[model samples]
Target: MAQWLDAKVTKRIDWNDHLFSLRFQCADFPDYTPGQFTKVGIEQDNGVVSRPYSLVSHPQDKELEIMAVPVEDGVLSPKLHELQENDDLKVMAPATGFLVLNEVPDSDNIWLIGTGTGIGPFLSILADSEIWLRYKNVILVYAARHQNDLAYGDFIQQCQSQYASQFSYVPIVSRDKADGMLHGRIPALLQSGQIIQQAAQPLDAEQSQVMLCGNPQMIEDAMDVLKSMGLKKHLRRSPGQISQERYW
Candidate 1:
């Protein structure tokens, strides 16, 4: 059984034609970890159509935030994209996911990599100050199809400024010309060792912990590249150097 509470849309930031970020204020917000997700729904003529979205806001934030990209024919996203301030939405608690920092073991460096809306959880993780204290270095590698598709650039820049030497932000654009951003897919960057080169750090299995999120194929391809470097999937039963979450 799950509890569904009403959440009011407080703010909406449109990044591009297809991507946006939504902020919701819930009366009885569930206690959630940094990298957890909640199910959101809207009343439909036939029934309630719901989808799970990762929380982008840190636990200390007053409101919950979730980022999304509207699929052309998506059941939830199209409706979600049309949401206006003060609109009521159904939010199912308690948020759940295995992508939290506790799943990662001690390492010299932590890599947070994502594509598209998969970057949601990573944003939450970065917002929490605990990660800065826990790891020696934190790197965020965000990949999008176009330069404008990159969301939260300002926020990420703020984090880099605040963290100074300990944080790094790398943006990858696959289909557009970006003066300073990487210009290839994440898997290719990993395979070519360009990501590590850009970061000026080593990504060995023993010293690095990696988290991957987004398209399943990207995850699979990146895992293969990581495996070749001696990193294996991290599991509760068999902990390793890598963890992942797949976006539908």
Candidate 2:
């Protein structure tokens, strides 16, 4: 079992009206693998209420970061949104998950698929230099409702600019049409072969590794599609072609 650790709010990165990034400083923090999540608890009348949040920073960082989507009616979410500098937070557990960088084998191409806040873990893993050197090409497929809903857009752009040849950001907007960005959902792109065209290469099961993170429905759909294409699900004991971290 993990112990509750006291952490303080270090900074916040506001993505939009609904989304914000919360950074916390945990003293003598436990080491965590990329794609793991923590249970953050709030002091309530009866006891403590907690929610699971994916870590957005690698273990190397002294501080840990997690993104939050404020639900006005939610008990913990609203309180999370209201956190300010020097505010205290109680993390009731250590970061834990099977979906992480260790599952990925050395490959020529890697596909990181995410929707909404599910992109957090991928962002953290990709930023690590060790993972970057293992794969020749890193293709990130990030789909959101609108451009404004896409978090960390500027940082992603900077990463692409810095590693021009090795990185690819395929932003898909479902509700709005934007210049130089893919239109429609990722499922549609896969169905119409647009993703392949945009990728400029065939997505072969043997040559690629795909990491998926998002809602249950999206995860199911992606699993079906990738399975049909000969990709296999990976686990701790048995590694395979596809790995998933269903945040929901």
Candidate 3:
């Protein structure tokens, strides 16, 4: 059985018409790793409906934060979007996920590639200072449909300022025009060697570790491109260079 605790919405930030982030205060919040997810439940006519949301805040943050793109007909998203400050929701304890840095072996560079709301976990990971200590370089490649869809710009900028020598941010806007942003999909950027050219670093199986999250199609396609470069999926028994998580 799942353990659930009552939480109160402390704050909300609406990034756009379709995307928003919510911060909830949970008295029983667990000590979760940076890339883990927690289940959020709301009572509905159907009894209770819950969904897993990756934690956007660092493990030490007093409030739990989650970024979400509201689906037109999603059972949980619509309701979640309607939530206001002080609204009550249920948060499941013992957050879990496999995207943590512990799963990745030490490497010279760490590449975080994400699309849409998939950028959530990366936010948590970057906020934690440990990643800066472990890897010599940390690069974030975020893909969104439009310029405005790029979330956490301020936070990422703060990270860049704090870890100036070691951190880099690359924003990829696929559909709309954007100044200083890569206007293409992630896989295309990888295939065309544009990302590597911009980073000025060679991403090989030996010296680079990669974590990919976002649209299932994007993940699959990006994996294909990475494989061509000799990067294989990381597994427990056969650890390799690439690790992935699918965000629905």
lDDT score, candidate 2: 0.83
Q: Please list all clashing residue pairs in model 1, or write none if there are none.
A: none
* Residue pair clashes in candidate 3: none
Error of 1 at 125 (Å): 0.4
lDDT of 2 by residue, 168-218 (tens): 888888899988778887766876778767866556677888888987777
Task: Compute each candidate's TM-score over C-alphas.
Answer: 0.98, 0.93, 0.98
lDDT for each residue of candidate 3 in 71-180, tens digit (9 for 90 to 100) = 88888988999999999998999899999999998899999999999999999999887799999999999999999999988998998798888888889999987887
In order, the Cα lDDT scores of the candidates are: 0.91, 0.83, 0.91
Pairs clashing within candidate 2? none
Candidate 3 Cα misplacement greater than 4 A, ranges: none
In candidate 3, how many Å is residue 136 off?
A: 0.2
Q: For every model in order, what is the number of clashing pairs?
A: 0, 0, 0
